[model samples]
Target: MKLLIMSDSHGWADEVVQVVDRHKHEVDELIHCGDSELQVDSKELSGVKTVKGNCDFGADFPEEIKETYGSLTLYVTHGHHYNVKMTYVPLSYRAEEVGANLVCFGHSHVADCFMEQGVLFINPGSMRLPRKPKEQTYVICDITDTEVEVSFYERVSGEKLTDLSRTYSR
Candidate 1:
Protein backbone atom coordinates (compact mmCIF):
# COMPACT_ATOMS: atom_id res chain seq x y z
CA MET A 1 0.00 0.00 0.00
CA LYS A 2 1.04 3.58 -0.59
CA LEU A 3 0.08 6.56 1.56
CA LEU A 4 0.33 10.29 1.08
CA ILE A 5 0.85 12.18 4.35
CA MET A 6 0.92 15.90 4.98
CA SER A 7 0.54 18.23 7.92
CA ASP A 8 0.59 21.75 9.37
CA SER A 9 -0.74 23.46 6.27
CA HIS A 10 -2.25 26.13 8.52
CA GLY A 11 -4.79 27.33 5.93
CA TRP A 12 -3.01 26.69 2.65
CA ALA A 13 -6.07 24.95 1.30
CA ASP A 14 -5.25 25.47 -2.35
CA GLU A 15 -1.77 24.05 -1.92
CA VAL A 16 -3.24 21.05 -0.17
CA VAL A 17 -5.69 20.48 -2.98
CA GLN A 18 -2.99 20.76 -5.58
CA VAL A 19 -0.75 18.29 -3.83
CA VAL A 20 -3.58 15.81 -3.37
CA ASP A 21 -4.60 16.11 -6.97
CA ARG A 22 -1.06 15.46 -8.05
CA HIS A 23 -0.68 12.26 -6.07
CA LYS A 24 -4.22 10.98 -5.61
CA HIS A 25 -3.82 8.32 -8.24
CA GLU A 26 -0.56 6.96 -6.82
CA VAL A 27 -1.49 6.58 -3.20
CA ASP A 28 -3.89 4.20 -1.58
CA GLU A 29 -4.66 6.57 1.29
CA LEU A 30 -4.49 10.30 1.94
CA ILE A 31 -3.78 11.71 5.39
CA HIS A 32 -3.49 15.14 6.92
CA CYS A 33 -1.95 15.35 10.35
CA GLY A 34 -3.75 18.60 11.18
CA ASP A 35 -3.29 22.33 11.74
CA SER A 36 -5.08 22.59 8.40
CA GLU A 37 -7.20 25.42 9.77
CA LEU A 38 -10.06 24.37 7.50
CA GLN A 39 -13.58 23.44 8.44
CA VAL A 40 -14.51 19.79 8.70
CA ASP A 41 -16.66 20.00 5.61
CA SER A 42 -14.17 21.92 3.47
CA LYS A 43 -14.14 20.63 -0.09
CA GLU A 44 -10.35 20.63 -0.15
CA LEU A 45 -10.37 17.98 2.53
CA SER A 46 -13.14 15.90 1.01
CA GLY A 47 -11.37 12.57 0.57
CA VAL A 48 -8.60 12.93 3.13
CA LYS A 49 -8.43 11.53 6.63
CA THR A 50 -7.50 14.31 9.04
CA VAL A 51 -7.06 15.05 12.72
CA LYS A 52 -7.49 18.15 14.87
CA GLY A 53 -4.57 20.32 15.84
CA ASN A 54 -4.35 22.88 18.59
CA CYS A 55 -4.94 25.65 16.06
CA ASP A 56 -8.01 24.05 14.48
CA PHE A 57 -10.46 25.57 16.94
CA GLY A 58 -14.03 24.27 16.86
CA ALA A 59 -13.42 22.40 13.61
CA ASP A 60 -14.81 19.15 15.03
CA PHE A 61 -11.93 17.10 13.70
CA PRO A 62 -10.94 14.11 15.75
CA GLU A 63 -7.79 14.23 17.86
CA GLU A 64 -6.67 10.90 16.46
CA ILE A 65 -7.65 8.04 14.19
CA LYS A 66 -6.69 4.39 13.83
CA GLU A 67 -6.99 2.58 10.53
CA THR A 68 -6.00 -0.78 9.16
CA TYR A 69 -4.91 -1.31 5.57
CA GLY A 70 -3.90 -4.78 4.50
CA SER A 71 -1.49 -5.97 7.19
CA LEU A 72 -0.55 -2.55 8.49
CA THR A 73 -2.22 -0.51 11.20
CA LEU A 74 -1.79 3.26 11.28
CA TYR A 75 -2.20 5.64 14.19
CA VAL A 76 -2.62 9.25 13.09
CA THR A 77 -2.78 12.37 15.23
CA HIS A 78 -1.89 16.07 15.34
CA GLY A 79 0.54 15.48 18.27
CA HIS A 80 -0.11 18.53 20.43
CA HIS A 81 -1.81 16.58 23.19
CA TYR A 82 1.07 14.16 23.19
CA ASN A 83 3.72 16.91 23.56
CA VAL A 84 5.47 15.69 20.43
CA LYS A 85 7.52 18.85 20.20
CA MET A 86 9.38 17.69 23.29
CA THR A 87 9.46 13.93 22.95
CA TYR A 88 7.96 10.91 21.24
CA VAL A 89 7.43 8.90 24.42
CA PRO A 90 3.79 9.79 24.85
CA LEU A 91 2.96 9.30 21.22
CA SER A 92 4.84 6.02 21.13
CA TYR A 93 2.89 4.72 24.11
CA ARG A 94 -0.38 5.67 22.52
CA ALA A 95 0.53 3.94 19.30
CA GLU A 96 1.49 0.82 21.16
CA GLU A 97 -1.77 0.85 23.05
CA VAL A 98 -3.61 1.11 19.80
CA GLY A 99 -1.54 -1.72 18.28
CA ALA A 100 -0.28 0.40 15.45
CA ASN A 101 2.61 -0.46 13.16
CA LEU A 102 2.95 3.06 11.84
CA VAL A 103 2.43 6.39 13.58
CA CYS A 104 1.90 9.67 11.75
CA PHE A 105 1.87 13.06 13.43
CA GLY A 106 2.88 16.73 13.19
CA HIS A 107 3.25 19.61 15.62
CA SER A 108 6.78 20.96 15.41
CA HIS A 109 6.74 21.58 11.68
CA VAL A 110 9.88 19.49 11.30
CA ALA A 111 9.86 16.64 8.82
CA ASP A 112 11.16 13.37 10.19
CA CYS A 113 10.80 9.60 9.98
CA PHE A 114 12.35 6.81 11.99
CA MET A 115 11.83 3.39 13.49
CA GLU A 116 11.80 2.73 17.19
CA GLN A 117 10.84 -0.45 18.96
CA GLY A 118 9.35 -1.92 15.82
CA VAL A 119 7.08 1.02 15.03
CA LEU A 120 7.63 3.61 12.33
CA PHE A 121 6.95 7.27 13.14
CA ILE A 122 6.56 9.97 10.53
CA ASN A 123 6.15 13.72 10.69
CA PRO A 124 5.61 15.35 7.30
CA GLY A 125 6.41 18.86 8.51
CA SER A 126 4.52 22.04 7.68
CA MET A 127 3.64 22.81 4.09
CA ARG A 128 3.00 26.50 4.73
CA LEU A 129 5.16 27.30 7.75
CA PRO A 130 8.18 25.07 7.75
CA ARG A 131 10.80 25.07 10.46
CA LYS A 132 13.91 22.91 10.21
CA PRO A 133 15.45 22.42 6.76
CA LYS A 134 13.39 25.41 5.60
CA GLU A 135 11.50 23.34 3.08
CA GLN A 136 7.74 23.18 2.71
CA THR A 137 7.27 19.42 2.57
CA TYR A 138 5.04 16.36 2.69
CA VAL A 139 5.65 12.62 2.56
CA ILE A 140 4.66 9.58 0.56
CA CYS A 141 5.13 6.13 2.00
CA ASP A 142 5.43 2.94 -0.03
CA ILE A 143 4.83 -0.20 1.97
CA THR A 144 5.49 -3.84 1.27
CA ASP A 145 5.82 -7.02 3.29
CA THR A 146 9.54 -6.57 3.87
CA GLU A 147 10.14 -2.86 3.72
CA VAL A 148 8.65 0.63 3.91
CA GLU A 149 10.07 3.46 1.81
CA VAL A 150 9.36 7.08 2.69
CA SER A 151 10.00 9.97 0.38
CA PHE A 152 9.59 13.66 1.15
CA TYR A 153 8.63 16.15 -1.51
CA GLU A 154 8.46 19.88 -2.03
CA ARG A 155 4.83 20.81 -1.56
CA VAL A 156 4.51 23.42 -4.28
CA SER A 157 6.77 21.95 -6.92
CA GLY A 158 5.89 18.30 -6.32
CA GLU A 159 9.55 17.46 -6.69
CA LYS A 160 10.89 14.60 -4.64
CA LEU A 161 13.56 15.44 -2.07
CA THR A 162 15.76 12.44 -2.63
CA ASP A 163 18.09 13.35 0.22
CA LEU A 164 15.25 12.92 2.67
CA SER A 165 14.19 9.50 1.44
CA ARG A 166 14.44 6.51 3.73
CA THR A 167 13.76 2.79 3.55
CA TYR A 168 13.12 0.81 6.69
CA SER A 169 13.02 -2.94 6.93
CA ARG A 170 9.63 -4.22 7.98
Candidate 2:
Protein backbone atom coordinates (compact mmCIF):
# COMPACT_ATOMS: atom_id res chain seq x y z
CA MET A 1 0.00 0.00 0.00
CA LYS A 2 1.05 3.63 -0.56
CA LEU A 3 0.24 6.46 1.85
CA LEU A 4 0.65 10.22 1.54
CA ILE A 5 1.19 11.86 4.93
CA MET A 6 1.24 15.58 5.76
CA SER A 7 0.87 17.76 8.82
CA ASP A 8 1.02 21.14 10.54
CA SER A 9 -0.38 23.12 7.67
CA HIS A 10 -1.47 25.77 10.16
CA GLY A 11 -4.17 27.21 7.87
CA TRP A 12 -2.57 26.82 4.46
CA ALA A 13 -5.61 25.18 2.94
CA ASP A 14 -4.74 25.75 -0.70
CA GLU A 15 -1.34 24.08 -0.36
CA VAL A 16 -2.95 21.08 1.30
CA VAL A 17 -5.39 20.76 -1.57
CA GLN A 18 -2.61 21.08 -4.09
CA VAL A 19 -0.48 18.40 -2.49
CA VAL A 20 -3.40 16.00 -2.20
CA ASP A 21 -4.43 16.62 -5.77
CA ARG A 22 -0.91 16.03 -6.99
CA HIS A 23 -0.70 12.53 -5.58
CA LYS A 24 -4.31 11.49 -5.22
CA HIS A 25 -4.18 8.92 -7.94
CA GLU A 26 -0.89 7.35 -6.90
CA VAL A 27 -1.56 6.87 -3.22
CA ASP A 28 -3.87 4.41 -1.54
CA GLU A 29 -4.50 6.62 1.50
CA LEU A 30 -3.99 10.22 2.66
CA ILE A 31 -3.36 11.33 6.24
CA HIS A 32 -3.05 14.69 7.92
CA CYS A 33 -1.43 14.80 11.32
CA GLY A 34 -3.31 17.96 12.23
CA ASP A 35 -2.87 21.64 13.11
CA SER A 36 -4.73 22.19 9.89
CA GLU A 37 -6.68 25.09 11.41
CA LEU A 38 -9.53 24.22 9.10
CA GLN A 39 -13.00 23.00 9.85
CA VAL A 40 -13.72 19.29 9.95
CA ASP A 41 -15.82 19.67 6.82
CA SER A 42 -13.25 21.73 4.92
CA LYS A 43 -13.04 20.78 1.28
CA GLU A 44 -9.24 20.71 1.40
CA LEU A 45 -9.37 17.86 3.87
CA SER A 46 -11.87 15.80 1.97
CA GLY A 47 -10.97 12.10 1.85
CA VAL A 48 -8.00 12.63 4.16
CA LYS A 49 -7.92 10.98 7.57
CA THR A 50 -6.99 13.64 10.15
CA VAL A 51 -6.60 14.10 13.90
CA LYS A 52 -6.84 17.09 16.20
CA GLY A 53 -3.74 19.11 17.02
CA ASN A 54 -3.05 21.37 19.98
CA CYS A 55 -3.90 24.40 17.88
CA ASP A 56 -7.18 22.92 16.69
CA PHE A 57 -10.04 24.54 18.60
CA GLY A 58 -13.12 22.36 18.25
CA ALA A 59 -14.10 18.86 19.30
CA ASP A 60 -15.13 17.76 15.84
CA PHE A 61 -11.77 16.29 15.01
CA PRO A 62 -10.56 13.19 16.82
CA GLU A 63 -7.42 13.25 18.95
CA GLU A 64 -6.13 10.10 17.39
CA ILE A 65 -6.99 7.41 14.88
CA LYS A 66 -6.11 3.80 14.12
CA GLU A 67 -6.51 2.30 10.68
CA THR A 68 -5.70 -1.03 9.13
CA TYR A 69 -4.56 -1.28 5.52
CA GLY A 70 -3.96 -4.75 4.24
CA SER A 71 -1.40 -6.18 6.70
CA LEU A 72 -0.33 -2.85 8.13
CA THR A 73 -1.83 -0.97 11.05
CA LEU A 74 -1.41 2.82 11.34
CA TYR A 75 -1.77 5.02 14.41
CA VAL A 76 -2.12 8.73 13.67
CA THR A 77 -2.01 11.67 16.08
CA HIS A 78 -1.02 15.34 16.28
CA GLY A 79 1.68 14.46 18.88
CA HIS A 80 1.21 17.34 21.33
CA HIS A 81 -0.75 15.17 23.77
CA TYR A 82 2.14 12.74 23.76
CA ASN A 83 4.80 15.44 24.18
CA VAL A 84 6.40 14.34 20.94
CA LYS A 85 8.53 17.49 20.72
CA MET A 86 10.62 16.00 23.54
CA THR A 87 10.48 12.26 22.91
CA TYR A 88 8.59 9.43 21.29
CA VAL A 89 8.30 7.28 24.42
CA PRO A 90 4.75 8.30 25.16
CA LEU A 91 3.70 7.98 21.55
CA SER A 92 5.41 4.61 21.33
CA TYR A 93 3.44 3.30 24.29
CA ARG A 94 0.22 4.50 22.73
CA ALA A 95 1.02 2.82 19.46
CA GLU A 96 1.71 -0.44 21.29
CA GLU A 97 -1.59 -0.09 23.06
CA VAL A 98 -3.38 0.35 19.76
CA GLY A 99 -1.49 -2.58 18.20
CA ALA A 100 -0.19 -0.37 15.40
CA ASN A 101 2.97 -1.10 13.45
CA LEU A 102 3.19 2.32 11.84
CA VAL A 103 2.95 5.55 13.83
CA CYS A 104 2.40 8.93 12.13
CA PHE A 105 2.74 12.21 13.98
CA GLY A 106 3.76 15.87 13.57
CA HIS A 107 4.58 18.47 16.22
CA SER A 108 8.14 19.71 15.96
CA HIS A 109 7.92 20.48 12.27
CA VAL A 110 10.97 18.36 11.65
CA ALA A 111 10.55 15.57 9.12
CA ASP A 112 11.99 12.23 10.06
CA CYS A 113 11.33 8.48 9.95
CA PHE A 114 12.80 5.65 11.94
CA MET A 115 12.21 2.18 13.34
CA GLU A 116 12.02 1.51 17.03
CA GLN A 117 10.82 -1.51 19.00
CA GLY A 118 9.66 -3.07 15.74
CA VAL A 119 7.50 -0.09 14.90
CA LEU A 120 7.96 2.63 12.30
CA PHE A 121 7.45 6.26 13.35
CA ILE A 122 7.18 9.11 10.89
CA ASN A 123 6.98 12.88 11.27
CA PRO A 124 6.07 14.69 8.05
CA GLY A 125 7.11 18.10 9.34
CA SER A 126 5.16 21.32 8.88
CA MET A 127 3.73 22.25 5.52
CA ARG A 128 3.59 25.95 6.31
CA LEU A 129 6.06 26.55 9.11
CA PRO A 130 9.06 24.32 8.82
CA ARG A 131 12.09 23.85 11.01
CA LYS A 132 15.39 21.92 10.97
CA PRO A 133 16.15 21.41 7.30
CA LYS A 134 13.90 24.40 6.73
CA GLU A 135 12.01 22.77 3.94
CA GLN A 136 8.22 22.70 3.93
CA THR A 137 7.74 19.00 3.51
CA TYR A 138 5.54 15.90 3.59
CA VAL A 139 6.05 12.18 3.16
CA ILE A 140 4.96 9.32 0.99
CA CYS A 141 5.35 5.77 2.24
CA ASP A 142 5.42 2.71 0.06
CA ILE A 143 4.89 -0.48 2.01
CA THR A 144 5.47 -4.12 1.18
CA ASP A 145 5.90 -7.34 3.11
CA THR A 146 9.64 -6.95 3.47
CA GLU A 147 10.28 -3.24 3.76
CA VAL A 148 8.88 0.28 3.76
CA GLU A 149 10.21 2.99 1.49
CA VAL A 150 9.68 6.53 2.74
CA SER A 151 10.16 9.49 0.41
CA PHE A 152 10.01 13.09 1.50
CA TYR A 153 8.79 15.81 -0.83
CA GLU A 154 8.66 19.58 -1.07
CA ARG A 155 5.11 20.59 -0.23
CA VAL A 156 4.65 23.37 -2.76
CA SER A 157 6.66 22.04 -5.66
CA GLY A 158 5.76 18.38 -5.25
CA GLU A 159 9.38 17.54 -5.89
CA LYS A 160 10.97 14.57 -4.17
CA LEU A 161 13.76 15.29 -1.71
CA THR A 162 15.78 12.24 -2.55
CA ASP A 163 18.33 12.86 0.17
CA LEU A 164 15.69 12.26 2.82
CA SER A 165 14.40 9.03 1.30
CA ARG A 166 14.85 5.87 3.34
CA THR A 167 13.98 2.21 3.21
CA TYR A 168 13.55 0.25 6.41
CA SER A 169 13.29 -3.51 6.78
CA ARG A 170 10.07 -4.83 8.24
My TM-score estimates for the predictions, one after another, are 0.98, 0.97
* Best candidate according to lDDT: 1
The residue-by-residue lDDT of candidate 1 on 90-137, one tens digit each, is 999999999999999999999999999999999998999999769999
lDDT of 2: 0.93
The TM-score of predicted model 2 comes to 0.97
Q: lDDT per model, in order?
A: 0.95, 0.93
Highest TM-score, which number? 1
> For model 2, how does the per-residue alpha-carbon lDDT over 64-109 read when each residue is reduced to its tens digit?
9998877799999999999998989999999999999999999889
Worst 10 residues of 1 by lDDT: 125-134
- Please give me the total number of clashing residue pairs in predicted model 2: 0
What CA root-mean-square deviation does each model show from the true structure? 0.7, 0.9
